[model samples]
Target: MSIWKELYDIFDKERSRWQQSSASKQAIAFELKANLGFLADALSSGLSQSAIASGLECSIFEAKLKEGAALTALNRRKVTLTFIGEFSEFAKYVGKENDALVENAYSKIKSLQKLVAAEPNKSHDLRIKSLFRFLVFLVAHLEEQPLSRTSAKKAEG
Candidate 1:
């Protein structure tokens, strides 16, 4: 019933429909592999999590996802790296595990970069969409996780 699970089923259906849909399957699988720790850390360190989760700035995140999906292979590379750099720097001052947070952010972005880099433009768009869907789900799911919920409670209490 969770959104993440539904999105996951859609991913499976896509892979089945496309047969050897390597790019999409691979991208979606990699994101699904992300541990809860990494997801919590990424939400804490990512620039737009709070805004998107709060429904105040979903537009920017949506625009980025849409634009990245439309970008050519080379431009996707540029956009991915730009995001990596921004997330890396943003993670530095986010909290206690500064180094590890940067590493986590770097790892996530680099994996997406690799996915985007390996596929042609036509297939790359699907790769971007798969990753974007995972991210959107993350933003929403954080609200239901102890990670964000506990923190919010602490701040309130």
Candidate 2:
């Protein structure tokens, strides 16, 4: 399937999982569209692979707060997939972009950390959850073959 189709599929799947009212779903969809736009813009900027990963991970945290306006658009509550499942998907994306994704993720995370530290107390739970979600997303997007499987094989020796 085309990338846009894949993204739409992901969005549809996630949207169906939500039990919220129609109004709420509409709001969520609106936010998601905005978020996707931001993601696209970021992708166009020629960010390093690490940068994309970093942005993906870091944006999760920002999605929760007003300060993370850039990322808040990406929020999709009632995410259907488990954290691990989300991570697995992200790992696939990371596999495609490797070094660039990692660098992107790292840089984005640093910026996110700064924002989180600035707020400290407000929306703490959401902030923490966002961070965890980002980590899961990163793990999912990263290449699966080389890192864990190879390491495990070596360890079994």
Candidate 3:
């Protein structure tokens, strides 16, 4: 199956899971975070720097619109996905010690769902770009972790 189809399927399943129960929401958030992390690693390893840089430039251009109106009209789905990416990083940092962090991640994921649902007219390309941005943010967070502290914590654990 195409990547777009796969992503759509995952989104559908996650949305359904989100509606089932509180536990399901947690599960969906965890699954999405793991999937995005894996995608980030795969993209980082598979794609050339130039290709990634070009994509980043385009996203930056869209983000930097000087006109306040244009900026306000930015895709809500993308904004929500970015928030999900951020919450994922926070959850990773807090680990299992903080239920609130995980809950916040789930909440952001739900917000993304709502945005997508409300904006059914959004293009597939927009959704894919949002997902890519999320993965990039996640990868950056993973790479930002201090190795010394991480190792020390692991040893303590």
Question: Total backbone clashes of model 1?
Answer: 0
Off by over 4 Å in 1: 1-108, 118-122, 145-157
Compared with the true structure, what per-residue lDDT tens digits does model 2 show for residues 54-88? 34433433343333222212232222233234235
Model 3 regions more than 4 Å off: 1-33, 38-97, 122-157
Indicate whether candidate 1 or candidate 2 has the larger lDDT.
2
Name the 10 consecutive residues with the lowest summed lDDT in model 1. Answer: 70-79
- Worst lDDT window (10 residues) for model 3? 67-76
* Candidate 2 vs candidate 3, lDDT winner: 2
lDDT of 1 by residue, 22-71 (tens): 34333332433343335444445663432222221223223434434221
- CA lDDT of 34 in candidate 3? 64
Off-target runs (Cα >4 Å) in candidate 2 are: 1-96, 140-157
Query: How well is each residue in 21-129 modelled by candidate 3, as lDDT tens digits?
Result: 4443333334545645543554657744233323222222222222221221211122233333434433343332223332333344444445555664554344444
Candidate numbers sorted by lDDT from highest down: 2, 3, 1
Each prediction's whole-model lDDT (CA): 0.37, 0.42, 0.41
Could you tell me the lDDT of residue 71 within candidate 1? 15
Best by lDDT: 2
